[model samples]
Target: MKDTTIDDISLISIPKIKEVRGNLGVIEGDVIPFEIKRVYYLYDVPSDAQRGGHAHKELYQFLIPLSGSFDIKLHDGINKKTIHLNKPDKGLLLVPGIWREMDNFSSGAVCLVLASQKFNEADYIRDFKTFKSFKR
Candidate 1:
């Protein structure tokens, strides 16, 4: 597994075009670090609820908050960081091998995740212990 750190994470700004009707944000394949293969979103989370308590072995992800706000706690076995997501035109880029936990979700917060790979159960490391071992 790769040794990831907070430095590897970046806040990407999506292109926004302002119009009289409304504003639009565009995300193209070349805009991000990796090509997106899967797309998913989390919504309807309770204020006290949390999500994403796992690490990926090879998959990369980009997280964006479509509405409200939330915090994503990332641990790379050696370092940890907390990132807040609230803007629709910004996203958090998460590299592989970093364990992550999403929490502090406000009511009606919608988190959109763009993945570099398709869903594979084996790619997930759900246990902190196992994820730490992979870091070593």
Candidate 2:
């Protein structure tokens, strides 16, 4: 029984070229079609700790689970959806005005995130209550 608020989240599967012993995953312009300006990863997290408890005001993000699995709870001010990221060849496309939280991450999970813009504190809506108000 988990409680989530956002709903527009979906699993995005990227194209993968397979080989004999190795596989290559690519996110081309035709694949994602968004200008990825920022790239980052989340790692070295404690077992009971949770990450990503904020909402972006204008930043669109693509989230990929490079290793292990995790649950992405997304809220679009009205509806809610929980997206699970476990495969490296897929990612989650999160649009702006969506409140998101990442939790239930397995041990040694690596989350790769791609953003449409650089770091900006004004672009993030940290307070959940304020996010709700802005949702309208």
What TM-score do all the candidates reach, one by one? 0.96, 0.90
lDDT string, candidate 1, 16-71, tens digits: 89999988999986779888899999999888887989999999999999999999
In model 1, what is the error at residue 54, expressed in angstroms? 0.7
Cα lDDT, model 2, residue 24: 89
lDDT of 1: 0.91
lDDT of 2 by residue, 6-62 (tens): 444556788899999888898986666479999999986665777888888778789
The TM-score that candidate 2 achieves is 0.90
Segments of candidate 1 deviating more than 4 angstroms? none
Give the clashing residue pairs of candidate 1, or none.
Answer: none
Q: State each model's CA lDDT, in order.
A: 0.91, 0.81
